[model samples]
Structures are given as C-alpha cells and as structure tokens.
Target: MSRPLDKAGWQAMADTLTARLETRAYIDDRFVDAAGGETFETINPATGEVLARVASCDQADAELAVAHARRAFDGGEWSRLAPTRRKRVLLRLAELMEAHRDELALLDTLDMGKPITSALGDMAGAIGAMRHQAESIDKLYGEVAPTGEEALALVLREPIGVVASIVPWNFPMMMTAWKIAPALAAGNSVILKPSEKSPLSALRLAALAQEAGLPRGVLQVLPGFGHTVGKALALSMDVDCLAFTGSTAVGKQLMQYAGQSNLKRVYLECGGKSPNLVFADCRNLAQVAHHAAEAIFHNQGEVCIAGSRLLVENSVREAFIEHLLAAAESMQPGDPLDPSSFMGAIVDATQHRRILDFIRQGQEEGGRLRAGGEALDGPGLFIQPTVFDGVTEDMTIGREEIFGPVLSVFGFDSEEQAIALANDSVYGLAAGVWSQDVDRIMRVSRRLQSGQVFVNNWAGGDQSVPFGGVKQSGNGRDKSHHSLAEYTELKSVWIALN
Candidate 1:
C-alpha cells in the first residue's frame, strides 16, 4: 500500500528524521567527531537537498576504532562473554530495531533514494535476519572427531578477533545487518564503515546496538570515503577478518591490502550482471514479463543480483518483447518517499550519469533500444526503466555489470545455445530459468556457472541459503550458516586421555 500523502503524518515523520540526523558518526558507543570535527555534507538523493553534515572519518578515526575493537576483543568483556549473554544482546538489538522501524525506514529513503515501501521491507528483513542469527547461537555445537586409541580430539569453533565490515550504499541498513549480525553472534568485535552516500542508518544502528547493552567498542560505525578509512581498516594488523560488499575492483584491492599488511581473512560479495533465461516452453508470457520487469527495475535496478541480461528463446521473442514493454511502463521512477513508487531515484548524480553512459554505450554497440532510454525530467536523479532488445552476447551491455534499471534481451534457438550465451559473461553471480520441462531445468541448472540459480523466480531466497558469487563476482557467501565460517576459526583440541 502507498503511504498516504497525509500532510500532517509526513511533516511529523520528517521532523523525527531530522532529529535522528543531528548526530552523524557513532564511535566507541558515543556520538563523536573526526579528529577535528571535520564533516561532509550528506545529500538527500530523493530531492537533491542537503540532509546533514556527517563526520568525515579518515584513517585516524579508523585507527581509533580498530584500537577500541582490539581492546574489546582482547579484554574478553564481549568476545569472551557467555554465548547466551551475547545472544541476548543481539536479540535485544533486533527488538530495538523493530521498535524504531519507521525512523529507520525513513532514514534509508532520505539517505539512499529507495522507495519507502522497499526500505521498510529491507528493514523488516534485516530485523528478521538479526533475530535468526541471535537465535542460532545456542543451538550451534562443535564436533568431536573420531580418533584411534591414541588420543581424544575435539573440534571447536572460535571467534576470529576484530572484524571490519565495509558495505555499499545500496540497501544500507540490511547489508549492514548481514555483515554485523553474524560477526557479533559469532562473538567477534566489529567495526563498520558504511558508504559515504548513506551513513545515517548505520549510525542509527550503532546507537541501537549500544542501547541493547552491547559493550563499548563491540560495534562502531565510521562514515567516510573508501580510500582513507576503508583502506585503513583493511590494512590494520589487529583486524582478524574483513567482510565487504561492493564493486569487484574494490573487493580485489581490499584483498591486496590484507596481504600487504597481515594475512587477515577477507570475504567479499561483489558485482553481478545476472542473466534471466526464458524458454518457449514457458507459456505464461504475462507472468514472465512481470517478473522480468521487477527483476531489473526493482530499487531503480541498483542491486548486485539484478537480472540485467534477459535471454529468451527465438520462438517467443516478439510476443515476450510486447509484454515486457507493457510491464515496464508500470515501473517509472517516482518520489522515493512515496510508498507507492515502485522505482526510485538512482543513488546519486554520479551513479545516474554512469547508468546513462552505459545506455549510450549499449546503443553504440548495436543493441536495439526497446523501451525507456533517457532520464526523466524531474528534480531527483530519476532514470526511466530502460530495456534493450536484440542484444547479442558480444554487446557492451550484455557482458558488463551496469547495476542500473537497464535490461538487455537476447534470443537463443536451442537449450545449449541459451546456456552458452548466459554463461558467456565474466561474472557468474546469479541466473534464473523459466520453464516447465524438468529435463531442461536440470540440464541448464547444472551447466550454468553461477553461485545461485532460480527455477521460476529471479533473485529471491531466504536467509537460510548462502549468497555469493564465483569468478570476477568475488568469493564467499553472506547468509546461512556458511557465513558463520567466515567469521570464526575452527580449532582442533587434542587430549592424551588414553
């Protein structure tokens, strides 16, 4: 349901949002400064208005945060706390987040230009995931290895030391929770560095964490450019592990930084140009068209797992295009604060230009522009939900990760041809297949080189499943029990009890 444009309700919500933004960065369980009170202006992507001046934390601030985290981890006040105590704190944090859901959702929409409805959904997902991680702690048990008559061996899962989480601007609150909740639940101290474009929610989450009775330095939020603070966290010798979600280029650089300083564990969930494959056997053209539209245009098409490439069978090409165009019209960009908006503004002017540049490059490379192509004439950085048909596997848009609301459609004749075209990209993050034939689904699902594949849907799964990529998309998963392995070190303790 669209949030009613109730003037009084909106005005009150806006006032509450402004109050939340009064303080920017949260460090060591307190709202503080960046060495000299230096701050950067945060823009409201929905309206191109200045929201607030946030602390522009740099290497110095990162160093201070790392120091505090190291102390907290070494002191055992938090890191060595009983699992039940830690779980209680995390569960409490989840409760606090739910209580302030409206404030957090508004903060996300104002800071990152996501539709209010989408932001609320993301907030709810974050809360549920955090609660799940908290609940899983007591149930987790280590193993006992079978040894011969010589010795008794016990396998233990131990928390890695301080964890530095670097997250991107898109889905700020939820991504932050994806990294922090697991690390905290695993008993590791964490330092979070959120994107400069959307730091408000992360800062607010830090306050909530403290309110939940988490020890000082257990969780700290730093807001700044990636080069200074993010680099500092990556290179810090005291940091035991680094979890990041962003571009493949930055993820690679962080790996280098890890190697250069200390061989700390680095887990990255990077870019994607996911392919959505449709076969002629799928008779539901209308449903397919709708899912295809939502796969790309959702969140202004600013998702890592966005189905940016659409590969359809040649038999259904013309009919699919017609329905797809009809579906695209419903996803035009609108005011992000309005819950009715299905598509919101691009994260910022810089990203908007990048998307447009990619569109022009797609045209230059001979891809046919089917639907929306240009940015809308409006106040915010809103682009039309674009679709390019007759796309070949060789086109620039077909191979590269646009990370926008642009979908490139290609037609293939046979099952093998479709698999070949879908697997042609350098990325193998995600892919989706639509068909009723069990044989085709099994064959394609096996041969398709990707971390995750959807049978009837595109880009969906619960927190129970692992999420990550292969090849240039980067390594390691984010959700599920698999992610806990990234934050903990397995140890084998042996005893000569014989």
Candidate 2:
C-alpha cells in the first residue's frame, strides 16, 4: 500500500483494515486463542467502539509461551544460528515491515488513537531499529583481555536464552521493535507481551517475523494485561531475561517478580516528568516556544520523556507563555484517522480521566491555567492541549508524571535555579535546555540528572544515541549498540599456554 495523500485516503485505508483486524495471540509461529478460552475487547479510544475481541492471555498462556521459547533456545535452531544468518532473517523482517507499513500504522492509530500521520512517522523508528540491529549482528565482536605471558583471557558476549519483553501501549510498534530487535539480534528467543490496550501491531509483526524466516517458537506475541501475562512472564523460571518499557510503578513490580522467580535479569525503561529549560539568552524565544509546545503535546503527551515541566527565565516568562499558547492552538485534538490532525485521543477512558483529574488538582493548588483545561466535547477520549502557568515545584501537577498533554510552567531567575528545578522530580529520564550561551549550556547540562540532555533543542536524536533514565525513572538503555548489553550475558574464558 502507498502513502495516503489526504485524510479521506487515510480514512479509507483505516476502514478497510478495521474490518479484518487480527485479534488472536501469536505463539510458536501461529495465531491461537488463550488456553482458557477467555477473551477481552480492545476499544478504539478515538470512537469509543470495540475494534476487536482479542485473546486475553493469562498464566497458562505465559507458561506455554515460555516452554516454547525455552525449547527453541535449547534446540539451537535460532540461538545457535550464525550471526550472519540471523542478521539476514532480521533484515528480511525489516523489509516486510517496510512493505506493510501502512497496515501496521493503521493498526496502531486505530488501537491507540494516535494521529495517522504520527503513527506513520513511527514506522521509520521501528524499521530503522530492526535494520540497525540486524546490520550490527555480525559486526559485534568478542574481546580479549590483557593477560600474563602464560595465560590468554577472552571475554565473550552471549545471548541470554529466553527473553520476555513487556512493552507499553503509547508507541506500540516502535517500543516493541526497540525491545525485541536487539534481543532477537543477540540470538535469544523473545516472548513479547504488549499492553492489552494496543496489541494489534505486535501480533501483526509476529506473523511478519515468521514469514521472514524466524524459527518456530523463536518469537511470540501475547496480548493481555500486566498483572496476568506480564506477571507470569516476569516470574517464569525458564525465562532468562526480562525487558520492559512502561510506567515506573509497573517496572518496579516486574523487578520484584524477577527476584521471586529464578532471579532472571531485568531491564527497565520507565516513566519521566522531564523538564525543558528556557533561558532569556536563548537565540529565539519564538522558536523555543514552538518546540516546547511540541515537547509536551506531541502524541497527546503520552511520551515518557515529554517535557511536561517548562522552566523559563523569569525575565522572559510572560513572553514565552504567549508564544507557547499560540503554538498550542495548532495541536488541538482531532480524529486520529485524519492525516491533518496533530493531536489524537488519549489511549483510554481511564487515562483520559487521570489527565483531567490532574488538571483539576493543578487548579485547586492555585496554579493558573494559561490555556486549555477542559476535555473537548463529542466522542472519543480527547483532551485539549493544556498548559498551566505559575506552577510551583511543590505543586502536584509539577512533580508527578501525568503522562498527558499538560505543561506546567515555572519561573527561575538563575541557571542554578533552573537546574535545581529540573532535577527536583523523582524522574531523570530526559531534559532540554534552550540557550545560546555555550558556558551556561555546559554548566546546566552537567548539573541536570537526566539520561539525555538536549541543548538549544527540545527532542532531537537518532538511533545512534543511547536512551534511558537515571534515579527513579528506570535503569538500562535502549537503542544504539548499548541496548544489546541488556539482552546479552558476559562470560570470561581463560586459557593457559604453559
């Protein structure tokens, strides 16, 4: 399918795909139902309609999937394959994803209510991650350690047998690809548990993997809730490693589950209330405001690294807010199927209500609502792009991770104060500083306790950069070659030359 030129063309494509959406879980290279025959309806947040009745996998399904993954890994059909052979298979999977880009984009937009345009844009990141990891497979090399004259030491990186990846709903295909591509590229059997809110893309991708020559049981997708299928996978004794991208609370829970089971290795990329700082010395306040609005409102602010907290220099705070309001006007919520829409509905009613509640709390705490503060009328779980000025560091809306299109503005007089405010939150995922002063940028970027810091920009990075968080946000990295470390184990072999 080609790229749709307009809203109608995209809508027509979406209608066609919705009529025949895949709902079955993919296991052992085939689509199947839950062993208990239980099912759950996945709702389209855009229209408040049921898109499909997906298999609601539970402990039994988790156990079955793990057994298959274990067998596949132990059987060496995939885990023992040559790196070049595995690379070819992964590259083929990437090609299939590119061929089916439109279908996969529609599945995510319909399931999670992101704008079709945004959903389509996500495909580049998803496919690029796969291709990058695939190309890196054979290129990765084991290292030799400096040793005494009579001894030779070798340090090797090997796949951790069975990996369970739990991805969130916000960026379904992209997050799934980020977690699984490297794990699969490392020659580990992966069992993916996508958030039940949006599982269509993951299921579809699993089928594509099989068609791309992935061995049976090498890759599986289970569509279900975190407490059941997610918990089961984290606690499975046969599962050697677990990788997750979601809320900080759930990330912590999975860590506990890992400890209770076989002490499996767990890697987490969790939540953030990331801050964006704007100094009076910024080269362009108008440009900074435009990017700042995008920093918080893009994808309905569902981004874990969304710059929800905006700390501006006190001298230019008022002017920046005015420019920010104008930028926010262009991001009003609309139909996800429409290519012209900039913002889409929240993932579900629960998330919609949570965002609204946070807005109300901001008001009650004496924070002034500078722009939108109410949910838009009509169907779907839509909330207008909201901004709250006069937000204090201690305010509820300023400190917590709302994970919505809500921006809390704060004023600081000094660079030290800006750094202090940005690092005050429990999260340290990502941060941004908009200033032309090189010294100030250097000073603030070093002081801010975030995993990634952008100077004179909002959110701009590619697959080559390592991404993750520090403090409570989460541990471990995703993307770049650093990610492969999460899915692999290190072993040392020493040989005596005597």
On TM-score, the candidate that comes out on top is 2
Per-candidate alpha-carbon RMSD to the true structure:
1.7, 1.0
- Report the lDDT tens digits of candidate 2 across residue range 142-174: 999999899999999899999999999999999
The digit string of per-residue lDDT tens for model 1 on 132-196 reads 78887767789989988898899998899999999998899999988998999998999999999
RMSD of 1: 1.7
Score each candidate by Cα lDDT. Answer: 0.89, 0.92
**Which one is best on lDDT?**
2
Candidate 1 Cα outliers beyond 4 Å, as residue runs: 1-8, 20-22
Query: Clash number for every model?
Result: 0, 0
Candidate 2 colliding pairs: none
- Poorest 10 consecutive residues of model 2 by lDDT? 1-10
Please give the distance, in angstroms, between residue 168's alpha carbon in candidate 1 and its true position after superposition.
0.8
